[model samples]
Target: MESSLPSTQILDSGESAEGKNEAKNYNEVMSTLPKVKSLNGYDYYLYQGFWYAPFFLEGLMSVQEHFNPQSTDIFVASFPKTGTTWLKALTFAILTRSRLSGSTTSALLSKLPHDCVPFLEYDLAQNPSNRDLAIPLVSTHVPYSCLPKSIISASCKIIYICRDAKDAFVSLWYFLAKQRRSENVEPLPLEKSFELFCNGIANYGPYWDHLLGYWRASLEFPEKILFLTYEEMKKDTAAHVKKLAEFMGCSFTLEEEEGGEVQMIISLCSFEKLSNLEVNKNGKHRPDTSIAIQNSIYFRKGEIGDWANHLTPEMGARLDDIMDQKLKGSGLKLPR
Candidate 1:
């Protein structure tokens, strides 16, 4: 969705040469950024509002460059803070229970989620070896257009997770605020941040467009992309997990459950279980760019209606109007 932030008015194409030079200089300054290594055998530079790894981009450019999608391959795709952690945990647990055979070490099971389902962005950068981590797992925030061309052509099965925009904005706002506070940078106040969020100015945003891209793709390729919502999953995780397992061609057999395997997986990957794990709580997985820590454990509160705590009536109404207009006729309604 577009951020609600005030729009910047563009100058006419006939602007003076001096103005153009100034604009160029401004862009150059904004684009200057630190470089980091990518998981996919390349370096990435954070610049001009997006992470750019020419090599990784090239890797995603070709479907063949991607890990072959086995019948076992499972991909989790989402915009940030949309219950990605929950889905990752559930997917990992479901896939690995047969191997675990009823292990009670919740810590080990929690760790397994990250090990099994590496995020295409965060985890990949720190551990290049993770690029080739086994099949039945990969997660990404990359928009539909940016996904590997081969994935599209091959019709690889993908799970797209979505959440209520209000809850997403609240969680994202707090997360960013915490990061900025750690860095001693002034946090973006809620009103201003909300405005930017509405305008689609947040990281990897143009949020509506990003969501719509995937929503449309899922509609056109229903067999290939299983569209899921965070609210629905939160309401019935086990059922959704079963659906996901079935979609990925890995449904639990009645025989497996006769051994209590399903419950074991569910207990192991529960949010309370994973969030408290020592490895996740204390581990440093990424470079802390001016912040105290990197890769803060992803298992944040997975509660619904979190926006009620942060959004003012006026702001909420404004957002409601925007949602109504943008999502009109799309059969996608923002949860109240």
Candidate 2:
């Protein structure tokens, strides 16, 4: 099986004459964009009323100018902290199951998901290595409006998974809390963050808009996008794994399934197995970066409705009202 890892050259940092001109154009775009302070107190530029981290926007600019999407490329799209790590692990494991020998399969247990399946904007902006873009597995939290033209023009496959909006907010709140503490900054209280999130002021937020963008796209281009929900995936992970394999054009054969290949992929990527791995528990993902984060930070309590532990009745009710209003007539209602 051929690996989807990126080995293709991307014009990173605008070092060449053509690349430098592209960078100047992006710089001009950045200068005119609205900026806002995110919940973590970092500045994010607003486009279409949603906030995007500056670095991510820079990478998006690079991708727009240089990325030549192959029809076979697979992209995992989601809001931040909304089962992205889980989906990436499952997607990689499923796609690569036939490629690895039994002994080498153990490496999947050790390597972090972000290392195996890179984020399009975040990872590429930081490193600009051909390795990250060479892979078939790519991810992004960038809204549809801001995605590189090549992605849509080429009609690349996008698998978008969303969690219940309320739980997604709780997960974002907790994740940022950890990130801020690591940076020695005071984390925003849940009450305050909740208000801002509802008002659509967080990174990649107006969470409803993010979900709707992909959801509507999936409906229109069923061949190009697969929309999923975290609750639905948790309910029947094995079934969804099979669905994902088929969607990615790598369906397991009867012989493979009969040999327990599907189960093997599930076991390897399970929340319990991944969360407890030493590398995940102790490893820092790109520690040198300003947004240093632990591999374990992606684990958390991967349960449905964990938000109940944190959300007051009033808080939950307010979010529900917003979701209902925003998702009305879209045929998209999140699981409670």
User: Considering every candidate listed, which one attains the maximal TM-score?
Assistant: 2
**Model 1 per-residue lDDT tens digits across residues 1-336:** 111111111112226675455445534543466554322212344443344443333223223233344454567888777877778777766766666535664335445355557665434432334554455578877777666565576567789888878888888777767655655666767877787668655555556666777888889888788988888877776788778888887888988768766666667777777777776676644333221243453656768987887898788778778777777887776455
lDDT, model 1, position 88 = 78
Estimate the TM-score for candidate 1.
0.75
The lowest-lDDT stretch of 10 consecutive residues in candidate 1 is 1-10
- RMSD (CA, angstroms), candidate 2: 4.9
In terms of TM-score, how similar is model 2 to the real structure? 0.90
What are the root-mean-square deviations of the candidates from the true structure over C-alphas?
A: 9.9, 4.9
